[model samples]
Target: MSNTASLKKEYAERIVPALKSQFHYSSSMQVPVLKKIVINQGMGIAVADKKLIEIAINEITAITGQKAVATISRKDISNFKLRKKMPIGVMVTLRHEKMYEFLERLVRVALPRIRDFKGIESRFDGRGSYTLGIQEQIIFPEINIDSIT
Candidate 1:
């Protein structure tokens, strides 16, 4: 099957239902197919907690089970004032059909499980791009203090 068709099928048959069932939200959750995922390690985080950047990378890698590299988007970085900490953002491209499947699982199972969770707030960049803030990262099934080395 063509990638596009597979993506459509995946979205329609799998992702849509999962979102509704798991998140209590519709399949039309409205995530655009990402061309790339960028992890904007903002200066705020860079200065406040240098290790946090790595922590985000490690956590994303573990949760997504994908090799996600951390990079600085200068545009994202420049938006911040140097004196204050910047919020670090992770961007992942979802153009591949497989990404839809991963996104489905992540949104449905992994994300909502976070403790003290609230709905995700998204801002569409209007260039087929959106930015979302995940208030905190807790309740991930893989996390266990005892399990950590």
Candidate 2:
């Protein structure tokens, strides 16, 4: 087998069983289905600010109680080719029991709250991943105050 395949198989065998045990899933067959919810796309001036990223992560964690990883990619439209690096967006990966819980909350509760919101348009990124974009973060019901004391 190829090196990557071998590594993946080894990792899955070790990680899956452990995750099942840690999350008290009872059986490996009960592992929750993971869904990737992409939060933005850079067409115009998408809010790629640090504050926004923090707010998003905080809101997601608060609602889902799942830690999310946020990242920013700055637009680098130099050459005629629009192949510049842009602040893509944040990706929240929910795992184990949290995965199902988050999905339910996302579809039923969180999505409706987003203002001027439209359904996600999914497209793959060549690799085994999908991408989608949100126009604004107004959908989340999080208070964005200057100070949190």
Candidate 3:
């Protein structure tokens, strides 16, 4: 979409220069750049109902504009009655153009619609990446309210 194009252009035209001046970066690579955006939805109930996992995958695919991959357990935990290779959640990794498009939609359209919005809690990771959790996927326009299962 055009949003992705403008985002990339803005980075090159505006953001890069600002970073170069502020940090006095000798090289463009050190200024840092966004690599990917990962959208995840965890469905613990899927352990009880396999149908729920399929439904989750469909919903995540609709939200991210990409096929969703089911996240399986790495090892069995007897306390939780969880087993290895059992579908527990669904997720999609958006990269390049898709990442920009999703981010633009999230900031511009979806987030504001959340009822009683009180800003977000963001935590940065080891590198420059950060993780943000959205409790409701219904905030995005892509998901149909009636179609929710």
Question: What lDDT score belongs to each candidate, Candidate 1 first?
Answer: 0.55, 0.53, 0.88
Model 2 backbone overlap count: 4
Number of the predicted model whose lDDT against the real structure is largest: 3
Tens digits of per-residue lDDT for model 1 on 8-97? 687678877776777665446543335544333232455456576676667666655566565554443444533322334443444455
The superposed Cα distance between candidate 2 and the true structure at residue 60, in angstroms, equals 3.4
Pairs in steric clash, model 1: 36-93, 37-91, 37-92, 37-93, 38-91, 44-85, 44-86
Q: Give the TM-score of candidate 2.
A: 0.40
Q: Tens digits of per-residue lDDT for model 2 on 10-118?
A: 5468877888988998887776434454333222333434365565556556655667665554555645323345434445665545654555556666677766657
Clashing pairs in 3: none
> How would you encode candidate 3's per-residue C-alpha lDDT over 1-149 as one tens digit per residue?
48889988999999998999899998888888888888888888888999998988888888788999999999999888899999999989999988998988988899999999887777677877787878888999988999886
Per-prediction TM-score to the true structure, in the order listed: 0.49, 0.40, 0.91
TM-score winner between 1 and 3, please give it: 3
